[model samples]
Target chain A: MAHLTPTPVIEPLQDRTMILNMGPQHPSTHGVLRVILEIDGENVVRIMPDIGYLHTGIEKTCEAKFYQQVVPLTDRIDYLCPLTNNLCYALAVEKLLGMEIPPKAQWLRVLLNELTRINSHLVWLGTHALDIGAMTVFLYCFREREDILRIFEMVSGQRMMTSYFRIGGIALEPPLGFFEKVRDFADRFPSRVDEYENLLTGNPIWLMRTKGIARITAEDAIALGATGPTLRGSGVDLDLRRDMPYSGYENFKFKVPLGKEGDVFDRYMCRVAELRESLAIVKQALEGMPEGPIKANMPKVVLPDREKMKTEMEALIYHFKIITEGFSVPAGEVYQAVESPRGEMGYYVVSDGTAKPYRVHMRAACLANLQTLPLMCEGRLIADVVAAIGSIDIVLGEIDR
Target chain B: MALAPPITDLEKLKTHPALASLLDWNPGAIEGVKFDRDEMSIVIDRAHIRDACTLLRDHREFAFEFLSDVTCVDWYPSEPRFEVIYHLLSISKKERVRLKVRLDGSSPVVESITAVWPAANYFEREVFDLFGIRFSGHPYLRRIMMPEDWNGNPLRKDYPVEGYR
Candidate 1:
């Protein structure tokens, strides 16, 4: 509605600069992100991203729902990595409740989280390459992504919106042959990465399009609150999985890829390398899989299995009470930050020792990373904006949430 | 691990880096301190939050260079109705500390931290848009998620979950 007024979001500084409006619908933006660009001929003078087109007010909605009911809503925040959102929210609530997740559940969470990362990066690689005019990478990427989706569906019964991660632990025990399917996919995912790299990593056209385009310095990236591959691409060398380990990420061994140039290609290379590293973590999780209950033993907080609920009265009563009246959490706050595919996805949960959360705020990495767009795209060619947007890998759903 | 009780006493928490630095700089600036759930939260006096933030960011021992997030919590029907939460991270040290500034229900206003870390721009705008809390000296304080012509701040407890319509 603000844009409807006669004055622009950013006024032109010089006479030569003319205002140009990019998509709330343009394909390169990846979502309903309306960027108002002040251009001088083909060069961008200033850029301000106009968002909130996808705002669903999920945070306000979370206050009204029971704690467990909020997991399904987290899935909609960032569709690319729904489980990552699920994990972040679940961990935050669990921290508030001070519940101990079993070893098997932690390992399973790590294994599936890495798979979600690969799944997210594949879609990013495919779509990013396509945005850069490389068509084959998109096709090759979705091929592997389909396998990951199938793995998700096998475990959660839903492919995209898998609200699989519960507050105390996971929703259900991972089904039979889930590990085999994941292991089989993991065995072949590296070659698939090679296939993607061979297509774009060596292509001169791809290099010309991405390298040295929309370059940002390390200081600027950190100052602007950039995280994930965007910050790693700027050579920050900070990964929450390693620096601040959670969900048993401390047990996994993997390398954090870094980039010196902070260009589109460097960010591109960082994510691609992360694919291999994520696969390595997945393999490790598979080899050292733990054996125990998927859900926590706290029946007051966790739902009982169907068989137990039917056989035992106490179990059924606990399930009914948990369903009807949610378990209360301690009156305090905890901010849980996880290294998601995009960046540091944080969930700040505050409780009033009640069944419903008093406040639930998501510190979306994209919202902060989006601030760096002006720094990256200003003074660069207009087309470089596309490359820059792709480099950041923004999901407007997360940005506007 | 069993859940340990939170340490709310200022004397016990003054040894922490953030609280220690703030106490060293100006003891009057800190109103309260909390070490809960493995996180440290310092409730700073509203008048001195900006200076406290500057000190915390530049201090040699605890260089919390990264402003991880800025959000607000509304304790409706209470005198101090809003608590503006700032989560700061020391990237080099791998540590985090939360800074809170409470504002009365009559006038919910606090100094903007955008001057310290430019990353606070959008976050502050979102807070202003959702909770109607004003951040003084914010460059362009506009409604970010809601329409500019929207009626009320939807996040406050007084606002109905559904809508006026």
Candidate 2:
């Protein structure tokens, strides 16, 4: 019986590096990302990233759709921060249309975008902690994320793909109790953040795994085009919200958090600090809720009021016409950049005097940030590869779009 | 939380000293400059893209250190079939400028600015992937968002949105 039983055999490589494939299906690769790592024993010699498994060709699809019709497509790009994509595309098209959005709409956009930031960060923290072997923190983060998702569903009728931002303004004025619900959530969120800190901040294992690992310099971050927390974690004090304000972000008071060590732990601290700043902005927006129309006054580009469409013949006709034959934009191009959770999400839109765009290109932050992976992981232990990937906080949908 | 001043003003950016210095650097390189809806766009000859980008990045007064985006536009039946666009940012100034280079349909080739700003690496690869446009000296220019063995550049005007077998 012992002779009949087969034993598993192991082979060893001497004086040679072994090739290992990390993903396309692995759990910790985040989202369909594949990395080919060359390793010498436990140390990574080199790494090459292979993307595009999730490419939807959304950029090509934009050419066939109307300007207003493209908003829904942007929602699919970065699922975590759908409204930021919605806002960036809307702002670029709005620049071409030359329309003035109402102040109320602008302030609401500011408030919602901040909420989107918190939503995205929560997901990052949960999955990141889970990857690093902290199970309790993952569950706690999702509990709060559910509250935020509920708020999104209450306003936009969708949980994750809430394309709440329209060209001229937000999709709909939020329901009556929306602000109150948001206020309650905002009030309770800080203590929850404190709870997250209590779980991970003092844990020696968390510190040992994250601190001083996957380090990047400020200059390296800037040159590699890392943005959002990844860039800020490297001591670069550049936030589009503060530096290049759009959608009334300038009206809100908040701080841009910075990290000096440029390590995984520093990135974690920056994001935690950002959660506090975002909450402050949300509270300010709620307190100074403006009173005015939520949509722009441009009848040509904007859809007729739902109330007006019922009775007035003119409103009904305009609504029918705009929905069927989308408004035409002047022949030109515009670039709009917004501070999404991951980093700078930009849209370069070109119009050719037609309803359909001549070209629509997305400057996704995750793609550029992912390029720095090889630089950080090479010459380090293979265990740190997961930490490096998690620290980048990449969403493959955005990278491959 | 309280209100602070707005961070972006297109009008103030229009009169920036950096824009003035860029025009002064190589008068022959620029074709035209236009300001619309507070965004400034400068059309430059395709031949001088690398030099112009180098000037924009290295020159102290016009320190456009960030190459935010690189994309292309196709205008079928129009004289210049492709328009390669570059969006540059001056972080210290909080200002943005758009640079355009028109490429004839025949070749659609231009110099790579990756040397000036390493951030242009992935962006240029993306442009190559979607537009079939080539960068002159790109270290590794290949399909980024598409499979290595893909057919045509899907973003071109003639390529059907449904795609080809």
lDDT tens readout by residue for model 2, A1-401? 34222111113244698878888788899989988888898998878787778999999899899999999999999999998999999998988777788999999888889999999999999999999999898999999999999999999999988888888887788998999999999999999999999999889999999999999998888777888899999998999998888898889899999999899999999999999999999999999999999998878778877899999998888788789999898877778899999999999888879989988889999988987788788899988999999999999999999
Q: What is the lDDT of residue B62 in candidate 1?
A: 74
What does TM-score give for chain A of every model? 0.98, 0.96
> Model 1 segments beyond 4 Å from truth?
A1-11
Which clashing pairs does model 2 show? none
TM-score of each: 0.98, 0.93
lDDT of 2 by residue, B1-165 (tens): 111222244345435555666667877887777666567787889999898888887877658887788888888778788889988888778888888999988998999988887778888998898889999999888778777667788888889989995
> Each candidate: what lDDT?
0.92, 0.87
What tens digits encode model 1's per-residue C-alpha lDDT throughout A277-356?
99999999999998888888888999999999889999999999999999998899999999999999999999999999
- The DockQ scores of all candidates, in the order shown, are 0.67, 0.34
